[model samples]
Structures are given as structure tokens and as C-alpha cells.
Target: MLEKLPLGRPEIVVENGKQTTVAHSLKLKSAHIDDRLLPLLPTAMDAEQMRQRLAEHFREHLPNFEFKLSECHIRQVYYHPEKQCGVNYRLVFDNGNGTVFHEWLYGLMIPQGSATGRFERAAKRVKTSRVVQPFLQDFPPVSQLDDLQMILWLFPHDPKMKRMPDAVDPDFMKSQINEHAALLLDLPEAEARNWHCD
Candidate 1:
């Protein structure tokens, strides 16, 4: 299991002399691989299978969230005994009420043998397994259509790092959301694609 960890503070960005802080990163916990499955890595399972296994583990162990491997948009996966094993993927959810939410997950598998022991010793704390928490306490909750649209507005910015979109008016956009919320949320799927960063 993984222990819960904050994804760090929101990043501050300045574009065209205006500044804004973005908050959208998902919180994650570290999870260790089962010792019994150690040998399967270099033998029974390839990179894709390993990713699948970890994703399934999360879905099975975590409560209040759901994801199908088929619906996942896996962006990266890599494993190596000498360094680390990690996976990054995107998950989308629909509330069936004209509201949808999307989140990105990144997990790093525990390193084995001496490295694992060293990490624990260095931190001077015993590690505990935990299920991932989807959002930070400070994040705005999606209670209605407007809230969902606001979250969607944040999709293009990375919460963990400072980034400013080109030609964007951070303060103006924030101020104008109430005026444009309905039109933005009612946009067709094809037109809405323009809102996301490429």
C-alpha cells in the first residue's frame, strides 16, 4: 500500500505581467510491490502487464473511485531494478448528469533490496501502505455544473509546476467565468476540445 502524500503546493505563474496560481494536481501515495511477485517482473510480465497490474491493484484496493483498464489513457511506464519503476495514466469519470471529471495519476513502485532499506533509514520513519486521495483539501469541490467547468478550466495547467498559457488572461478569465459559465459548459464536445491544452 502507499502512504498518502500531498502533491505539493500550487504553482504560481506570470504571463504578460499578470500572475496566477494554479491548483489541480492530484495527491498520491507510494505503494510497494509484493515480494512474491518480484520474479514475475523480468519473466512473466512485460512493461505493459506490470502497468496493468499496478492499475488494477489501485482500483481493487481503493474505495470511492472506479477505473477500467480499457478506459485508461496510459502515458508512460518504466521499470528497472537499479533505479525505479513508475507509471502515469489519465482517468476520466462521468456523473451521468452532464458533468464529467478527469484526473491524472502517477505512481512509483517501491525499489527492492538495499535501496528500499536505505530509503526507510534515511527518512527515519517506517512506511505504511495507503489508498490514494483524489484531491487536496484546498481544492474546490465539484458541486454543480459551474464548479465542473471551473475545474475543466484548470486542466491545461500543471498544479505541481509553474506554468502560464500563452495569450491567456488569468485574472480576466477568473473574473469572467460567472458570465460565461453556461455557454462554456454547454459547448459541444468538438468545440470544447479547444479549451484543453495540446
Candidate 2:
């Protein structure tokens, strides 16, 4: 079944000095996965841990790359240790070809002693707000956590595809997430604090 379906989603294919979005062959960044591989994802938030997970999957994966905070204007901003379980972590990665990639990670766990009924009730109240607005019914693919966590990486689309309002663009979405975090979380001025990586 896995071999019958394409190994990965279609992405921009670079031709002879011209770039076009096409269904290229399998590459780690673009390769789709089945349930068996999801368990390899990093369970912790440490930079090393995350890179290690990626390395384990992609042979050519680069663990060394310069990255800035998701929110550059903010200083000393970090995720809340205890509340970092829910949908979070939006990051931008330079593809080294003048194209940028956007990656989003999400996981929402009901706290201990919190009944499912109460959690569902709270989810209903806040689902429409900026906090988890992107998550409602999105049903994004789970990351390596095997259960509640999932990740989605957005690649550059063709010009017409990009023109569509719902086109995938990581930087734009990252800003929206930052803005939502600032407002909903009541973060400090000039700083964006999160329950996980920006």
C-alpha cells in the first residue's frame, strides 16, 4: 500500500535554472510517512533532541543551522513549561535555495484531574478564539509522538497556487501564531512568550 501511493506530497521542482512545482521523487523533507515511523519523533523540546530525531529519519539531515527566535522582537521569551503540551511550535527553515519552509507542531493534552467533559467544554469556548483557531477540524498529521502530536511542513507553491488565500506560507502563519499568542496569552509587550517554541 505504501509503495502504491506516492512517497511524498508534490512540491516545487527545480528544473534547469527554472523552478516549478512538481511531484519530485522521495526526499526526507517531502517524504510522507505511515504510522510505524511516527514514534521516532522527539518527545522533548530541547533543540538537540529535535535535531536528533530529524537526523534519525533523514540521512542527509543537517543538525547545524542558524535559527532565530520565532518572535525576534521579544527578549527572553520561552514556552511555559507545564502548559507546553497543546498545539504549538511554528518555525521557519531556510531551504538554502532562496525558498523557505514552514513547520508546525501541535499536541493538546488535557491536564491531570481535568475531566474530558470539562476539557471539551473549555475547548468549545476557546476553539473560536485566536489561541487554537487554526486547530479546529484541521486534523493535521501527527508528528513523531505517536498519539496527540502532529506536524505539518508547508512548501512554496506555484504562483497561481500561492495567490489563493489559503495557500501555504510558513512565515505568514508564524506571524499569525505569534500575534495570537501575544493577545491570547497576554504576553509582555515587545516579547512573545509561548507554551512551546515559537
Candidate 3:
């Protein structure tokens, strides 16, 4: 069914060499998510154990590249040892990539909650925000996760897409999904435009 429909949503494809906005570039400065850091932090805050759950990604996966958050400025931090759900370790910087990751991971648990926490910028695109992290060992296919992976599967390594739960689409969603893949694959802006605007 998706193959028959034409893509109408035009995307704003910014090239790799292309310069990003001050806010965008600044955000890049504090981007990066080091999976290695996962084990470094406390097990509870590091990650949760569940059959299926959503997770927000970061621009860099680790903004500082080292994932050294020994003193990450905590804003509206959340943590629940009993429920194993909370935003206990999040970095919210008002300067440049403020709420860069906090908001991102927060978006991951939004559908289940009231979408609390800060970085209130009208959540980006859900297509890249919602993800199903099945632990490398579990390795759940991007398809099995379904709605959970609706947002994250498209852009697995984008912080901007982390809190973008409002980005996914059911209306010609495939086109949007394909458009996302094109953008990630380093397709030129002109070429990507053709894909999304088709």
C-alpha cells in the first residue's frame, strides 16, 4: 500500500558539510550517546529491564563524547527504584543544547505518562523519538517493536529526533520513513527533496 502512494511531505535536508544553526551546532557540541556509558552509570538509572519499551536518543549519544556526566546539571530529574522509571540522570543546559538529552529520554516515556519534564519545545518528530531498545542481546527487529519503534527506528543516532514524537506519521508514513532513511544515508539535499516531495 505504501508503494502506491506518492510522498508529499517535503523535508529540510541539511547536508553534513552544511553548517547548522547556532542552536543546532551548539546542540551538536553536547551531542553523542556512548552505549559504553550505560554500564558506567548506576544500573537503575543506566537502563531499565522490560519486554518492550521506548527510549530517546541523543544527537551525539554523548554530547561531550565521553559520556562523563559525573556532574551533569540536573533539572527536573526523575527516578523510581520501585517502578524503575524516572528521569534521574538528564542534562538540561539553558545555554546551547539545553535539555538536549533529558527531554529526549523523557519523550520516550511520554505516551505512558503525561509527557512531563522540561525542554518543552513541542517535541520534534515521533518518527525518530520513539524507539524500542531490546538490549543488544535481545535484538528485537525494528519491525517487531511496531509503535514503540515508530519514531526511533528511522533515525537511531539523532538527538534532535529523540524528542520528536510528533514527527511520525500514519498518513503516507512510508514516504516519511523513506525520506528519513534518505536523509540519514547522506543523500544530497536536492536528491532527498525529490524523495520527500515526490
Candidate 4:
């Protein structure tokens, strides 16, 4: 299931399926290909462990790739009526922008043509879009989203390293993400055509 981005419950998983959307909004339900799936995050013991897992996972998953998590700052503890206790990890990274890993999984999901062209089209469709077209490429996996307040790659809850895999399903992931999106945006579906996955 798509847990809240970054700091939400790490139980959401993304597997192969068709377009999955929340009932009210168009947030990405789990997308599928060949009944296979992309992965999702799982719980971490703590911030330190989470950091270790994600750092290594990226290196192993990408070739000739090196990303560092710097500016390791933290937000003051805050509580969400919904999130219970939510904390923000402030960090910067070197992004191949999932360019290598994306091709390895799904041929570059970013749309073709001028990135501006794609963004313009996508922005027109997504009502929640505040600025110009936010093409999946314009934002990429690294660009920050005003709504998500995240770069998307910061949380790698699931690992290729884990012995026992823990995955959340499409339906569950969609529900969680949709719920979170609505809570965050007060809009139904703000998902763009292309996914800015990490």
C-alpha cells in the first residue's frame, strides 16, 4: 500500500497492476506491468537503521551510482492527528534521478518531447498543479514537491537486501496514498501522468 510519502507508515507496497486511483482523486494507484510490480517501503527499526538500509540499497540497485545523504537535519517533533508522530529528515542528495534504475525496471517512464511540453500538458490536467507543467521529468524523482514536501527518494523502506521481503499490495498502497493525498491536498487525485519514483 502507498503509505504517506517519506514519513508515513512504511507498510505500503507497489506491485504490478493497472492504474489504481483513490475513489475521489487520481493519485497513482499501484501501476502494473505484466502482473509484476515495483517495490514499496517497509518499516525501519529507527532513523539510523533506515538511513543505512536506504544508502546501501541505492548503491546496489544502480550501477556506477553514488548518492550521499548530507545535511542530516531533523525537525522538531510534531504530532499529526492522523500521523501520530511525524518527523522530517532534512537531507540533500546526488541524483542520477533514477535514470539508471528506472530503465532497469521500466523503460524511462518520463514522457518525450520537450520536458516543458510534457509538463505543460500534465499541468493542465492536474488541477492541484500550482506552477507550470510538472512533468514527471521536470520534477523527476529528485525535485521537491510543494505538497509532498519531499524528494521521494528519501525513504527507502523496502530493501533488496532483506532476507524476508515485506510488501504492501496495490489496493492497500493506493488506499493509503490516496488517503494521504487527500489529507494533504484536500483534492481527490493530483497524480501526474508519469510517476516520479525513486
Candidate 5:
């Protein structure tokens, strides 16, 4: 099946007035082309889009919980060639009775020559680590000793497909949601309070 895919053009490099054609071949693992798993894959999205999607996902799975999204600003953390960028944004969940859980979410930006892409990526990377670190004392807890935890980082679109890789499984997503929901629901009020933002 992989062999049926079209090949890309050879890369040509010119150095010192000499042109060289370098052959390139497509190398794909079996999982990459698995037809059975393609429908379950996630599409690539930017940071803000990811945040909204995640909030929706959580709401769909755990309808009883209240989820809120906010931007976390960090000052002078990331210095891009074009502009300064912060690191991350945040998602806060509450039971509407003062028990809240905070998760710092950020997207890993693909390094690019474009100034806009460069700045956006740099901002999210820095915001998650720099700003969240001081307030929580440990932005990402070293141990999973509690229910409250930071969500996973988001990734940008694949340059080729313009979306995420096909490896993301719906079952895996469901499991993650279930695990986190269970942990959050089981957390004691005192412990949950500790996870609240200010």
C-alpha cells in the first residue's frame, strides 16, 4: 500500500556552480498507512483552536463540570527575532462550589522562517514553563500523586498533510478523558483547592 503512493521530486543542491540531484524515497511504517485507524486520527490545529476543542471535549465527556479557558501572560520570557512571545495559556475547571482544577496548556510551534509563526510558537512555549512555574512552584508536578494535573501539550499541523499524524486513537482519547475525569471527581475538596488558580 505504501508503494502505491506517489514519490516526491528529488532534491537538487548547487554548490560552487556544481548541481547535484539527491534521490529521496518515501519511508513509512505500517502504522502510518493503516486504513483501520485513519478515521480515529486527530486533525492538526493551532493553540487557540486546540484549547477550544479540548474544552468542548471535556464538556462532552464530563458534562457536570464547568470548564473555562483563559490566556496566561508571561513578561519578557521568549525573545523571537521579530517579536517577544509568551509561553502558554490555561484551562480551569470547577464544580461551581469553589473546587477548581487548573491545567496549563500550550502548543509546540513548528520553527519556521515566517515571523508570525515564529512569534506565536515562541509565546506558547514560554508561557507554559515560565509563568506557571512560579505560581504552582512546580508547573508540571514531578509525581502523579494527585488527581489534579496539567494536560498534554498540543502539536502543530504536519507540513505535508496539513494535519496531525494518523496515530492518534479515539480509544486513547476516551481513556485519557476517563482517567482524568475520575481523578478530578475523586479528589478531596482540600486537595482540589490546592489546584485552584489564585
Candidate 6:
């Protein structure tokens, strides 16, 4: 079972002319993973299955909000000679009325070098950040839509992150948009091929 961690609030800070959003006062109590599941850890379930599990977990704990799973993938991070592989999940949850929304990223690590594969740890904490609103206006009126539709509507209109002063990384931004479009919107392969971000 996943434990609930209380994260106080969200704040925005400007540093070196860049805007960053951060959450404070969030702490997760210790969580243990079942040792029997180590070997088949991340790959045991497909992305959709993982997303469903995440949604259920959050719904159980956060009954006041609606949850949407935005992204899920197996990720490996290198630390010098050692590497750690885990499942990374990005989720967006909103107040039932859609007046407020928060994004949370979670990481679950898998144990390595063990004969019986097992999950090493549950997510230590979920750092929640507010979704960036477009400069011209607030998020569209998406309250009436279902969870998936609300996410798709808000995602495309999300303000692109600025890499530096008055500039954006077009390739990186396009890839992000394209990936979400393909995955969430289920765009046809040919249509996705022709999609362009500008």
C-alpha cells in the first residue's frame, strides 16, 4: 500500500532569469516493496497497466481529486560506475471542480544483482508542481470533460518551457508535444509523422 505524504503548497521562483516551480514540506514515510516481485519489477506490467495501478492508488488516497496518468516509462540513471533502473510516472490530479491542478512525479526503484528480482523501494515522495499556464490566459475551461480529455486539452496548450532568455528548444519541445499527442491522443502513425510543433 502507498502511504500519503502531505505536501504543503506550490511556489514559483525566478532565478537567473528562469522561472521554476517547486513544492515544499512534502515528506513520505518509509515504504517497503515486496521482495517476491524484484526480478520482474518494471517490465512486469505494460505502461497502460502501470498507469491504471497508479490512478487507482491515487484515487484511493486522494478521493477529493481526479487523477490522470500523463507519462510512464522505465528509466535508468547512472551514478559513476553504478546504475539504477526504475519506473518513472508522471500524474496530474485536479480538484473535483477543475479549478486547481497539480502534477506529481513518482519513481519506484528496482533491486539489482539479486537472484530473485524484487522491488527495492516504493516512491519516497511525490513532489507536486502546478501546471504552467499559458501567458495569454489561464487553462481552458476543461472541467466538463472526462479525465483523459481534460488532460489532452490542457497538455497541448501548455506553455513551452524556455531553455534560456527569450528562447525555446524547438526540437526538445516538439518531441515532448509529439510524444504526448501520440500516446494520449492515439494519433494515427501517419498523422503523427506529419505533425509539427511551432
| lDDT, candidates in the order shown | 0.35, 0.33, 0.28, 0.30, 0.33, 0.33
Superposed by TM-score, candidate 6 places the C-alpha of residue 60 at a distance from the truth, in angstroms, of 1.8
- Best-fitting candidate, measured by TM-score? 1
lDDT per residue, candidate 3, 70-180, as tens digits? 233212222221122223223332324332322222312223222232112333222233333322212211221222211222223233344333344344456566668
Say which candidate scores most in lDDT.
Answer: 1
Model 4 lowest lDDT segment of ten: 102-111
| Candidate 5 residue spans exceeding 4 A from truth | 1-54, 57-86, 111-198
Screening candidate 5 with a backbone cut-off below 3 angstroms (N, C-alpha, C), the clashing residue pairs are: 86-123, 87-123, 87-124, 87-126, 87-127, 88-127, 88-128
Model 5 error, position 48 (Å): 8.2
| Steric collisions counted per model | 3, 4, 26, 14, 7, 4
Query: After best superposition, candidate 1 residue 100: deviation in angstroms?
Result: 2.6
lDDT of 4: 0.30
The digit string of per-residue lDDT tens for model 2 on 62-86 reads 2343332222010111122233222
Q: After superposition, how far is residue 129 of candidate 6 from its true place, in Å?
A: 10
In candidate 3, stretches whose alpha carbon ends up further than 4 angstroms from where it belongs are 1-71, 88-126, 129-164, 167-198
RMSD, each candidate, Å? 17.4, 20.4, 19.0, 19.5, 21.5, 18.9
RMSD of 3: 19.0
Q: How many clashes does the backbone of model 3 have?
A: 26
Question: Which pairs of residues clash in candidate 1, taking residues 3 or more apart in a chain or in different chains?
Answer: 1-129, 2-30, 2-130
Which residue window of length 10 is worst by lDDT in model 5? Answer: 141-150
Clashes of 2: 4
Q: What would you estimate as the lDDT of candidate 5?
A: 0.33
State the TM-score for model 2: 0.25
TM-score of each: 0.30, 0.25, 0.20, 0.23, 0.24, 0.28
